[model samples]
Target chain A: MENSVDTLLPTLDDGIKCSAITSTDGLVLAHTGSGATLDEDFLGAMGAALFAFGSKSIANLVGGKMKDIVVEGEQGFVKVTILNDKLLMVTVAEPLKLES
Target chain B: MQQATTSISAVQIAHNIEKRRLFIEKPQSQAHVTNMKDAPIYKTRPAVLQRAQNQDRTPLLKGEPVKEVKIILAGNVGSGKSTAIRAISEIPVIGSDAKAIERNALHNKESTTVSIEYGMAYLDNSNLHIYSTPGQRRFDFMADVLCKGAHGMVVMIDNGCRDPLNEMDYYLHQHGRFLQNYPGIIAITHFDDNNTDTSLLDYSTYLLKHGLACPVVSLDARNTLEIKQVLMNLLLQIGDFKTGKKRA
Candidate 1:
C-alpha cells in the first residue's frame, strides 16, 4: 500500500507538484520529483525541525496531536499532512491553481 | 503759653522716637530655629521674595517612547486576506477594493495598492500595527512593497474553493522568496462551506514540502474567538523563533 502510494505521488497532478512521505522521526520514507538545489539532506533536516516545531506547538497549546501544517513563502508553498500515528505526507508546489 | 508749647513739642518728639524703635526692632519671641541647617539656606541671597521666584528653573525631559510590533498580511486575491487582518485588529480597518478600479487586465496599475488598509491591536501588552495588501494579482507589485520590513506575515487561503492547493501555490510564488526566512501563518479561511473536502493533514503535508516551519489553522474570519486563537498561535511561533526553542 505504501509503495503504491509512493508511485502515485509522482504521477499525481501538478497541484501535488512535489511529494514526500517522512517518518515522525523526520526520515524520508519516499520522495518524488525534484526540490530546490540547496541540498536534499539539508532540506530534510529543516523539514524535521519544522515538524518538531509544529508538533510541539499543537501539543503545548491545545494538548492535541498536530494533524497538518502549512508554511507559505515567496518561492513556493510547503504542506505537511499527517497520515497516521507515525507518518506524514509532504508536498511542495509553485502557485498552481487547485480551483478554477 | 511757652510752657504749653514746649509740652506739645516734647509729646511729638516722644511719639516719633517710639515709631523709630518699632521699625528697627526684630521679633525675638517667635519659634526658635530647631537646627542651624533649617535656617533659610538659599544658595544666593534674594533682594526680595519675588526676585527669588524669577531664578532659572530646572530643565524638564520627555519620558521614554513606547515600542510597537508591525505585522504584514500578504496573500492572493479572494484569499480572505483583508478579513484575516480585520480579525485581529482592535481598531477599524481601512482597505481598498482594487478590482473595482482596474477593470482591464492587460494594463497593470503601476501602483498595485490603490489604498492602504491598516489597523492596530495589542497582543500580550505589545502594540501591533497590522496591515493588509490588496490581494489581486495586478496589485502584487504594491503587495511586495507592503511586505517589505514586515516582522511577520499571515498568508490566508480559501479552503472551500475548488483549488486550495493552487491558491497556496500562488501565495508561494508571490511572497515565498521574500518571506523565506521570516515567520508566517497559513490561514485556511471559508471553512464554513458545505463542499469543503480538504483536511488539515492534507494541507500540512503541502506546507512541509515547502520551506516553512509554521502552523496551518482553520480560521473563520467572522468569528473573533477563533481569530484570537490564530493570533496566539502566530505569536507562539514567533516567540519560539526568537528564543530558539521548539514550539511545543
Candidate 2:
C-alpha cells in the first residue's frame, strides 16, 4: 500500500506536490511527499471531507455517484478520486500554467 | 490570462453554491431548487446568506430582515447532534451523513456527519433554522462555518462515551468565546437511567470550574418532546442574554 502511494508521485508530472490514500472518513492510510511543509493528517481529513460532501451532493441531487472532484484554488489544486467504496485517492498539484 | 482565471474562479464559486442549493432544497433531497416554486426564501435571498456567512447575529436580536432564528448544534462524534435535529425539525432534514470509514474501533456508529446538516422548525411565528455541525474533530471548520450568525448553540455530549466530562470540556473550550456572548446549553444524551456514575451536578460543577454558565440537562435525542424541551431552554437562554439577565 505504501509502495502504491509512493509510486504515484513519480508517475505524475513535476507539478504534483503530494498524494495520499485516505479512508472514506478521512484517515490517512498511505501518504508520500512534502512531509516537511504539508501536514498529512490535515490533508487526509480535508480530502475525505471534500469527497464525502461531493459524493453526497451528487447522490442526493442528481441521483448518481461522484467519480472525482477537482478544486482549483489560487495557489494550487486539490484532486480527489474514489478508489473504492471505503477509500479515496487525494492528490495536490500546483496550478497548471497555460503555454503562451 | 488574469481575466480567464477570475472567470474560472467565479464559475467554481457558482458550482459550490449550486451544490449548497441542492442540499438545502426544501423537498426530499432534490438538487435543483431553482425550478421549485415554493423554494425557501433564505435560499433565494443571497444577501441574507452573506450576512449569515459573515457571522452577523445582530439581526436575530433586532428582529429585522433575517426572519429565521439560527442555532448551531455541535459535539463529538456519535453524540446524537444529527438525531436531535431530525427529531425536532418540521421539515425534512438536509443531511450529509456518510459512512464512517475511520475510527470504527472507537465509535459504534457506522455513519458520521461529514458536512453540516440543516433543518427548520416553525415555532413562535418564526423559522428556527437548526444547523448541526459534523461531530468529527477534523470537520471543525464546518462547525465554525455554521456558527456564523447563530442566535444560540447547544453542545450535545453523549453520556455513554468513554469520558463524557472531558468531552464536554473540549467542546465548551472550543466554543467558549462564542458561548460567552450567545446562549450555550449542554444536553447530556444517551443517558442510562440506571447508570448513576455521572450525575447532572457533576456537569454543572465542571462548567463552574471552567467559569461557564451554560445550563446542563439530561436528554434522549430520539425523543422529539425531549429535543423540543432542550430547544425551548436554548430559546429562553437567548431571551435572557438579550435582556442582560443571563445567569452568572
- In model 1, the runs with Cα more than 4 Å from the true position are A1-100, B1-67, B98-113, B194-196, B243-248
Q: What DockQ, between 0 and 1, does each candidate earn? A: 0.03, 0.45
lDDT of 1 at B30: 28
**lDDT tens per residue, model 1, B79-160:** 5656666776778775433222332431233322233478886654346688876555534545666776776778887775
CA RMSD for every model? 32.4, 16.2
Per-model TM against the reference: 0.46, 0.75
lDDT, candidate 2, B94-138, per-residue tens: 877667765564376878887778899754335689999888787
Worst 10 residues of 1 chain B by lDDT: B37-46
Evaluate model 2: give its TM-score. 0.75
Docking level of model 2: acceptable
lDDT of 1 at B239: 50
- Which candidate comes out best when scored by TM-score? 2
